[model samples]
Target: MARLVYQPQSPLNATLAVSKRWATSLGIWGVGAGTAALFLLSVTPLVKREFLVKVPVVGSYYEDKTPASDKPF
Candidate 1:
């Protein structure tokens, strides 16, 4: 029978370089996806509509709070 060659069994060995590379790629991918999600959540139309207000020239035009003519002053 042929003698077996000695090989390293640790996860950090050169034999597992592909797995380590894949892990790094996955980390980068996750970061990119998270950043994209944050950007979309901030700039999406629904988010903008819910958070932002449409002001004409000066500022926001809210409803009047003064008493109406029908009510006593």
Candidate 2:
């Protein structure tokens, strides 16, 4: 008769698999996506003017007043 052998889970594996790395990477990805979206919204006329007009104080910033020199891709 052969006995079944069970292997114990190591703390190292658990620690390595679950860490702040996931959250950190997620935050980085979110910032990158937000930056891309903001750039796209700024470079192109995709965003509707009505939306910017409705926003409170920040409305003026996105109201297509950006100078040619200040524009970025």
Candidate 3:
């Protein structure tokens, strides 16, 4: 007769197979990705303008306007 082994069902049971150094590297990567996402979200207008200016046919006509006109009239 063979004995059955009991496996833990907690989340901690799932462990990354990589080394500790690689785990730290993953943290760094996560931080970098979060920072980049935040930066992109913060500068959405600038990113949109850049994308608009990169279009093949409409790029040449795109212009950046002064911020003064954005106030409520």
The top-ranked prediction according to TM-score is 2
Residue-by-residue lDDT tens digits, candidate 1, 1-73:
9999997678667657877779988999999998777557855656445543343552233323457976675
Clash pairs, model 2 backbone: none
- The lDDT values for all models are 0.63, 0.73, 0.67
Error of 2 at 61 (Å): 2.3
- C-alpha TM-score for every candidate: 0.35, 0.40, 0.35
Candidate 3 minimal-lDDT segment of 10 residues: 12-21
lDDT of model number 3:
0.67
Report residue 10 deviation for candidate 2 (angstroms).
11
Give a tens-digit lDDT track for model 2, residues 1-73.
9999998879997677776558788889999998787667754565537555457987777777778899896
The C-alpha stretches of model 1 lying farther than 4 A from their native spots are: 1-18, 43-73
Clashes of each: 0, 0, 0
The C-alpha local distance difference test score for the whole of candidate 1 amounts to 0.63
